[model samples]
Target: MRNARFLWELISYRPASASCRTLFMLACYGERIVFGLAIQAFFNTLPQHTQMTPELFVLFLPWLIAIAVRLIVVNFGTIGAVRFEFSAQALLQHNLFKHILQRPGFQALPDSVGNTISSFRDDTAIVVELLSHLGETCALIIYTSVVFIILLRVNVLITLLVFLPLCCIVVLARQAQKGLEKYRRASRTATSNVTGAIGEIFGAVQAIQVAGAEQHVVAHFHTLNAQRRASMVKDRMLSGALDALFGNVGDIGTALILVLAALSLTAGQIRPGDLVIFLTYLAIVSDFFTDIGSLLAQQTQARISFERMTNVIHGMPDHQLVAHHALHIHDKVNEESAPPAVPQPVVVPLQQLVVRDLCYRYPETGRGIAGINICIQGGTLTVITGRIGAGKTTLLHTLLGLVTADAGEITWNERPVADAAAFFIPQRSAYTAQVPHLFSDTLRENILLGLPEHEHTNDLSTAIHTAVLDHDIAALEHGLDTRIGVRGVKLSGGQIQRVAAARMLVRQPALIVCDDLSSALDIETEQLLWDRLRTSRTQTCIAISHRRSVLQRADQIIVLKQGQVEAAGSLEQLLTTSQEMQRIWQGSE
Candidate 1:
C-alpha cells in the first residue's frame, strides 16, 4: 500500500504534467491500433481487388494522418516526461536532505556518510524513474485491453488462451521477488561501502601519508572494489536473466495463439483477414505483457530504495519522502529557504537556563551523564571541566538536545524548554564543536554561510574582533575573501577555531556553548579569545575546558566524574576542596 502511495505521490507531484502526458501517450498508442485496422482492411479487400485503388488509398490515408498526429503527441509526451523526471527527482532529493537537517545533531546517519549519499543520489533517481514509466505503462494497459477485445471478436478461445501467459509472467515475477530484492540490496550496500571508503581515505590523506600506510590503504581499497564488482555482476546477471525470462514467456504465449488460430481456421470460424490482424498484433500484446512483468520487477527494487531513503530520515514514514513543499524550482536556490520552520511557542531573552535531574547513558558503553543538574545566569561564563569519559561533552549534548536524554527537564528563564533541539538555535543560543566544520569557500562566506549580506556586514566586524580573528584576517593574502581549502585545511588549526568562534559570535546568540573551544589554540591566542569575550557583559557561555587558564577565569565550574557532577564552585574553592579538580589543573599545567 505504501508502495502504491509513494508512486502516486511522485506521479501527481506535477499534476498538469501527469495529465497531459497521459493523454498524449493514449493518443500515441491509439495510433497503433488504427494502423493495425488499416492493414487488416487491405488484407480483407485483396480477394476482390488485386491492385491499388481509391478504396485502398482511403483505407491508408487515416493511418497516415494518425501517424503524423502520433508524431506530435509522442514528441509532446517525451518533452513532458523529461521535464517531469528532472523536476520530481529534484523535489525528492530536496525533501530527503531537508528532513535530515531537521533531525537532532547527535543522531548518526543510518549508515556511513557515503551510504547516505548513495540513497540521496541513486535511490531518488530510481523512484523518479518509476514515475517516468507511468505514461507508457498506463498506455500499454489500455492499448492491450482494446487489442484483446478486437481479438475476441475474431476467436474468443484464442483470446482467452493469450491471457494465460500474462498470468504465468505475473507468477514468475512474484516467485523471483525475493532474489531480485536480495541482489539489489547487496549491490547497493557494496556501492555504499566503496564510496564511503573513498571519502574516508581522501579525508585522512595526511594521516595515511604521515603513517606511511599508503600501500596498505590502496590494498584495502582494491578489496572493496573487488567486492563491489562481484556484487554488481550478480545484480546485473539476475536482471538480465529476468528480462530474457519475460521475453520468452511472451513468445511462448504467442506460440500457443498460433496453434489456436490454425485450429480455428480449419474449423472455418476465422477469416484470413482476422488471422492477419491477430498475428500482427500478437507481438504487441506479448511486448505489453513483458512490460508488465518488468514493471513488477522494478517495484521490488523500488521498495528497497524507498526503505533506504526513509531510513535516512531516521525512519520517518515513506509518505514524508514525497511530502508536499514548495520546491522553488524557478527561483534561485536558497540554503536556508523553507519548507518553513515549525513555530516555537515562546522566544525569550536568556536570563537563567536550568537543567534538573538530567540523565543519559550510552547504549553501547553505558558511560554517560546521569542525574546531572546545573544552572547558568545570563552574562556569565560557566565552564564544565572533566577528564576523558567523564560525560562532559555528553552533558553539553543533552543540554542542546543533540542526544535524547533518558530523563531530564530543562528550563530557560523559568520557562520549560519542551524541545531543546529546536529551542537552542541562532540568536538564542549557538554551539560550536571541538573540531568545527568549515567549507571550501571564502573565509568570509564560511562565517556568513546563508546569512544575508546586509545582515552579516552589520556584525561581521564586531564578531571578527571578539573572536581574535582580526589579526589573522589582516595577515592573509585576501583577508576575509581568502578561499579556505576544504574544511579550512589551508589555515592553521588555531585559525579554524577562531573562524568558527567568529561564526558563532556573528549571530550574537544569547548563549554560546563550546566543547573545548581552545583545544587548537596557543596560550596567547586562547587568553585573547577569553579576554575579548569577557568584555561583553551580556554574553553568556557554557564551555568544556580543562585548560588551567580557561578554568581559572570561570565564574562557576562544574566538575564531572564518571558521568556525575563531582563538584560545582569557583576555581579557588575547587582547588582546595576537590582533589579531582587539582589533578585536572596540574595535568593542564
Candidate 2:
C-alpha cells in the first residue's frame, strides 16, 4: 500500500514525463507477452510428428515474426525510458539549486553542492538501471504466471511439487536482503564523503596550499576510497553467493521435473513429445524467476540512492519564512533602455533598529545568543566589540537576516527587513570569501553587476577612483578593458577587495555593514577607505571592529560582554564614563 502511494506521488509530481514512462512499460509488457505465447505454441505443436513436412514449417513463421516485433518494441521502450531519466535528472538539479539560493547564509548546507553533483552524475546510473531492471522484472513475472497456469492444467500435483522449492528460494532471498541493505548504506555514505572531499579540496586550493595540508587531504581521500572499495566487495560477495545458490537449486528442480515427466510417460499418462514441450516451458520459467531475485536486489540499492537524493533536494534551511514578500531580481541581459529606477526605499518609522528580547541558537550546537534588547539609531556608525565566540558574528548575522533568531523581533526603521533593503559585507571581504566571480570580459563590465539602465559608462571610472583602485587598474595593460580571470584569480587579495568594494558602491546602497573588511590593509589604505565612505551623505555604515583606529571614527560604540550589552555611547563618553571601555582604550594606547 505504501509503495502504491509513492508511485502515485512520483507520477503526479511529474505528470508529463510519467505519461511517457507508462507508454514505455506498456510496450515492454506487450512484447514480452507476445514472445512468451509464441515460444510456448512453437514447442507444443512439435508433438505432431506425423504431419511434420515442408508445410509444417509454416507454423514457425508466426513465432519468428513475434520475436522481431518484441525486439523493436523493447528497444523503443528502452530509448523512451532513458530520455525520461535524463529530463527528470535535469529538473531535480535545477530545483535543488533554486532551493539552496533561497536558503539563508547558504553556507549552512555545505554538502548541498556535493549532493547535487553526486545525485545527477553518480546516482543517475543507479536510477536508469533500476527502471530498466523493473521493466524486465515485470515481463518475467507475466511470462512466469502464464506458464505456471499451463503447467497446472497438465497436472495439479506436479505443479504443487514445483512450487515447494520456490518457497526455499524466497527464504534465502530474504536472508540476502539484510546484507544488501547494509552494503547499500555503506556505499552511499562513502560516495557522499568522496564527493564532499573533492568539492572542499577544489574550492579551497589556495587555503590548502597556504596551510600545507595537501598530504593530509589526500590521505583522507584515500580513506574514503578504501571504504567504498570495501563496501562494493561486500555487496558483490553476498550477491555472488546468492546467485550461485539459486542457480544450483534451479538445476536440481529441472532434473526432478524431467525425471517425473519421463516416469509419467513410461506409465502411459503422457506422451514423449508432451514431456519435451513441458520441459521447454520449465526452462523459460526457471530462468525468469531466478533473474527476478537479482533484479529485486538492484532495486533495493536504487531505492537507497533515491532516498539520499531526495533528502538533499527537500531539506529545509533557516530564515526561510513563508515568504510574505518577494524581491524578484530578474536576470538583466544588456543596458539598452534606461535602467529601471531603483525601487523606492521601504518607508520605515522610528528612525532606528529595535531589538526586543531576541534569542538565537546554532543548528548543530545549541549554544547561541540568548535574550537581549537594544535600539540602534540610523545614520550612526555603530561599532560592536566582543571576545571571541561572544556572539558578535551571530548578532551581525541575525541583523543581516543570515540566521534566524530563536526568540526575538528585529525591526528596522520600525519595520522588519523583509527583503533586500541593506547590504552585508562579511569579515573576509567579498572577493576573499565569494571569490570575486568575474567573466572573461572588460573591467567596466565586471563592476556593473546588474548594469542599472540609468547607469552610464562614466560610473565605472567614478567607482574605481572612489575605491582608490584607479592607479592599480591604470597599471594594467587595458585599464578598464583588461579581462579578469575566473573568480579574479589574477588579482591579489587587496586588489580583489578593492574591486568588490567598487561593485558594491556601484549600486549606491542605502546601508553598508562591514565586518572588519580592512583588516588586511595597511593603516593608510584603511584610512583612505573610510575617507571615501565619508563622501556619501545618505548611506549609513555600521562597522564591526576591535581596532582602535577603526573605532575612533565611529559616531557610536557598543561594548558586548558574554552575549549582552556592557556599554553603549560615543567613544569619548564610553572612555571617561565606563571603566571597561577606558581599560580597553588604555591597553591599546
Candidate 3:
C-alpha cells in the first residue's frame, strides 16, 4: 500500500507524460499478442502439409507484418519511457535541492554529506526505475489477462493448470519481498555511510596529511567499505535466489502446458492449430509471471529509496524564516537611476530590535544560553564578547532564527521577528558565521550572490572597500574575476573572512550579525575594518568580537559568562564594574 502511494506520487509529477508512456507500453503489449495470433494463423494454414501455397504465403505475410508493427511500437514505447524517466529524475533532483536549501539551516541537515548525496543521486534514480517498472507492471497485467482469457477458451483445463502454479509463485514472491526489503534498506544505508566517509576524508585530505593521520583515516574508511560490501552481497544473493526460484517455476509451468496439450491433441479434444495458439499464449503468460516476480523484487529496493527521499524532503523542523515570503529588495530599488550619491552605502534600518529572556539548549548536550536579554537600537553597534564556550555564537544563532529558542520572545518594531509582514527584506538581517564559507566561483560572483548583475557593479566595489578586501582583489591577476577555488583555498584565511564580510555588506542589510569577523585579520586591518563600519551608515551592527578597538567603539557591550549574560553596558561602564569585563580588557591590552 505504501508502495502504491510512492508510485502515485511519482506519476503525479507529470501525469500527462506518464499517461503517454503507459499508452505506448500498452501498444507494445498489444503488438506482442497480435504477433502470437499471427503465428497461430501460419500454423493453421500449413497444418499437416508440406507444400508452400499462395494461401500459406498470405498467412506468412500477416506474421511478417506483425513482427514489423511490434518493432515500431517497441521502439516508440522505449523512446517515450526514456523521456519520461529523464523528466521525472530531473524534477526529483530539483525538488530535493530546493528542499535542502529551504531547511532551517546547516545544523538541521543529515549528519553525513554522503547520505544526502545518495538520496540526491542514487535514491532518485532507483525511484525513477521503479516508475518504469510500475508502468510495465500495469501493461503486463492487461496482457496477461487477455492471454489467460484466450487460453481458457482454447482449453480450460490447461489454462487452470497454468493459473494455479502462478498463484503459488505470487505467494512465494511476497515472502521473498519482505526479506529483500530489509536487506536492501541495510545495503543502502551502508552505501551511504561509505560514501559519506569518503566525502569527508577527501574534503579534509589536507588536514589528514598535516596531522599525519592517513593510516587512521584509511582504517576507518575500510571499516565502512567492508560493511557496505557485506550488506550489498547479501542483498544481491537473496535477489538472485528469488530470480532462480521464479525462473524454475515458470519453466515447470511451460512444461505442464505442453504436456497437457499433447494429451488433449491425442484425445482429439483440440486441433493442432489450437494447441499451437495455446502454447504461444502460455509462453506469454509465463513471461508475464516472471516479470511480476522481478517487479515485486525491485519494488522493495524502490520502496526504501522512496522512504529515504521523503524523509529528507519532509523531516526538517518547521522554520518560521523559511515560511516567510522573501522580500525582493531589488524590486523596491529604482533600476534605471544612477548609483546612490552617498559616499558611504546606505542600508535600510530596523526601527527597534528587542529580545526578552530568550533561552535555547542544544538537543544532544542540553547546554546553551538562558535568560539572555538585550535591546539593540537601530543604526548602532552592539558587541558581544566573552571567553571560549560562553555561548556567544549560540546567542547570535538564536537571534537570527537559525536555532529555535526554548523560551522567550524576539521582536522587531513591535512585530514578531518571524512575521513576514515585519520586514520587506529578510536580507536586512544578515549573518556571517565565525568560519566563513566560500563557494568555488569568481570572487565577484561570491560577493554578489542572488543580486542582479545590474546591482553588482558599484555596490560590489563599495562592499569590497568596506570589508578591507579591495587590496586583496587588486593583488589578484584577474581582480574580481578570479576563481577563489573551493572554500577560497587560494586566498589567505583573512581574505576569506573579508570576502564573507563583503558578501554581507553588498546586501546593505539593516542588521549585520557577524561572529568573530576579525579573527583572521591583522590588528591593523581589524581596526581599519571596524573604523570604517562604525562611521559608514545607520545599519545596526551586532557582532561577537574580542578586539579592544571594537569594544571601545561599541555603543553597547554584552559580556557573557557561560550561558548567561554577566554584564551589559557601555565598554567603560562594564570595565569599571565587572571583574570579567576587566579581565577581558586587560588580556586584550
Candidate 4:
C-alpha cells in the first residue's frame, strides 16, 4: 500500500503526460497478446499441413496482419514512453532543486552537500527507473492474467497445480525484501559519506598537503569505500538469489505442465495442437513470473530511495509542515488564475527596533542567549562585542529568524517582528557572514549577483569602493572580470571577506548585518571600510566586532557575557561604567 502511494506521487509530477504513459503501456500489452495469439495460431495449423498450402496461407494471413498492426503500435508506444520518461525525470530534477532553494533559511538543508547531490542525481534516476518499471509492471500483470485464464481453460487441475508454487516464491521474495531494503539504505548512506568526504578533501587539498595528512585522509576514505562495497554486494546478492529462486520455480511449473499435457494426450483428452498451445502459453506465464520477481526486487530499492528523498523534502517541524501543506494547497488552487509571486522590495522602517527578554538555546549543548534586551534605532551603527562563544552570532541569527527563539518578543516599528516588513541577512537586508562564500565566477558577477543587469556597472563600482576592494580589483589581471576560482581560492582571505561585503553593498540594502567582516583585513583596510560605512548615514548597520576603532565609532554598543547582555551604551559610557567593557576595550587596544 505504501509502495503504491509512492508510485502515485512519483508519477504525479507530470500529470499532463499520464494519459500518454497509460496508452503506451496498454499498447505494449496489446503487442504481447497479439504475439502470443500468432504463435498459438501457427502451432494449431502446423499438424494439418505438409507444406504451405493456400488454405494454410489464408489461415496465417489474419494473424500476420494482426501482428504487423500490433508491432507498429508498439513502435509508436515505445517512442511515447521514452519521451514521457525523460520529461518526468527532468520535471523531478527541477522540482527537487526548487524545493531545496525555497526552504526558509540558510540552514534549511537537512543533509550534507554530497547527500543532496546524491538525492538529485542518483535518487532521481532511481525514481525514473521505478516509474518506467511501474508501467511495465502493470502491463505484465494484464498479460499474465490473460495467459493464466487461457491455461485454466486448457486444463484446470494442471493450471492450479502449476500456480501453487508462486505462493512460496512470493513469500520468499517478501522475506528477502526487508534485508535488501536494509542493505540498499546502508549502501546509499555509505555512498553519500564517501562523496562528501571526497568533496571536502578535494576542496581542501592544499591544506591537507600542507599539514601532511594525505595518507590519513586516503586511509579514512578507503574505510568508507570498503563499507559501501560490502553493503552493495549484499544488496545485489540478495536480489540475485530471489531472481534465481523465482526462475527455478517457473521452470518447475513448466515441467509439471508438460507432464500433465503428455498424460492428457495419451488419454485422448487433448490433441497435439492443444499440447503445443498449452506449452507455449506456459512459457509466457513462466517469463511473467520471472519478470514479477525482478520487479519486486527493484521495488525494494526504489522504496528506499523514495523514502530518503521524501523525508529530506517533507520533514520539518509540525508547524512548518502545516504551513507548507496549506501553502501548497493554496498555490495549486490559484496557480492558473494567479500571477507568479514577485519578491517585494525591502522597505526598512524608520523607527526603533526593540528586543525584549529574548532567549534562545541550542539543543545540543543547552546554551544560547537569554533575557537579552536592546533597542536599535534606524540610521545608526550598532556594534555587538564579546569574547568568542558569547552568542553574538546566535543573537543575530535568532533576530533574522534563521534560528527559532525559545522565548522572546522582537518588534520593529511597534509591530511584532514576524509581522514587520524587514529583510534578514542575504535577502533584502544584506549579510556578510564571518566566513563568507564566493562562487567560481567573475568578480563582477559575484558582487552583482541577482541585481538587475542595468544597475550592475554602477553598483559594482560603488560596492567595491565602499568595501575598500577597488585596490585589490585593480591589482587583478582582468580587474572585475577576473574569475575568482572556487570559494575565491585565488584571492587572499581578507579579499574574500571584502568581496562578500561588496556583494552586500551592491544590493543597496537599507539594513546591513555583518559578522566579523574585518577579521582578516589589516588595520588600514579595516579603517577604510568603517570610514566608508560611517559616511552612509541613511543606512542602518548592525555588526559584530571587537575592534577598538569600530567600538569608538559605534553610535550604540552592546556587550554580551555568558549569553546575557552585560552592558549597553555608547563606547565611552560602557568603558567608564562597566568593568567588563573596560577590560574588553583595553584588551583590544
**In model 2, which range of ten residues has the least summed lDDT?**
318-327
Where's the lowest-lDDT run of ten residues in candidate 4?
Answer: 318-327
Q: Each candidate: what lDDT?
A: 0.85, 0.64, 0.79, 0.77
> lDDT by residue for model 1 over 1-589, one digit each (tens)?
9888887887778877765566677787788788888888888787789787788769878889998988888788777777778788888898888887877787747668998999889998888766656667888889889998888887788888878757777687778878878998899889999999999998888889999999999999999999999999998888888788778866787688778878987998877778888877877788786787678767777888988888887757667888877677756657575556444344466799889999988878887999998988988899999889899999989889888889989999898989888889888888899889999999999998877768568699999999999889999999999999988989998999999999999988889999999999989989999999899878899999999888888999999999999999999999999999999999987
lDDT of 2 by residue, 375-396 (tens): 7776556777656677767777
Best by lDDT, which number? 1
The TM-score measured for candidate 4 stands at 0.89
Hey, what RMSD does candidate 4 come out at?
A: 4.2
Candidate 1 global TM-score: 0.92
Score candidate 4 by lDDT: 0.77
Ranking by TM-score: 1, 4, 3, 2
Residue-by-residue lDDT tens digits, candidate 4, 1-589: 7656655664665544544555666565665556556556666777877887767556556556766766676677777667667766665566666566565454556778888888878887787787787777776678778877876776787778878777667766777777878888898999999999988997998899999999999999999999989988987788778778877876787788788878887898776656666666666677677777777777777777766666557654312211211123223555476656457565755467789998989878999999999999988999999988999998888887776678889876777766221345434477888989899999888888756667467877888899998778889999988999998989999999999999998877778889989989999889999999878787888999999888878999999999999999998799889988988887897
The model with the greatest TM-score is: 1
Candidate 4 residues lying further than 4 Å off, grouped into runs, are 1-3, 12-16, 19-22, 86-99, 104-106, 314-341, 419-422, 425-428
* Rank ordering of all candidates by lDDT, starting from the highest: 1, 3, 4, 2
TM-scores for all candidates: the values are 0.92, 0.78, 0.89, 0.89
Q: Flag regions of model 1 displaced more than 4 Å.
A: 157-170, 249-272, 330-349
TM-score of 2: 0.78
Q: Is candidate 2 or candidate 4 better by TM-score?
A: 4
- Please give the lDDT score at residue 324 for candidate 3: 24
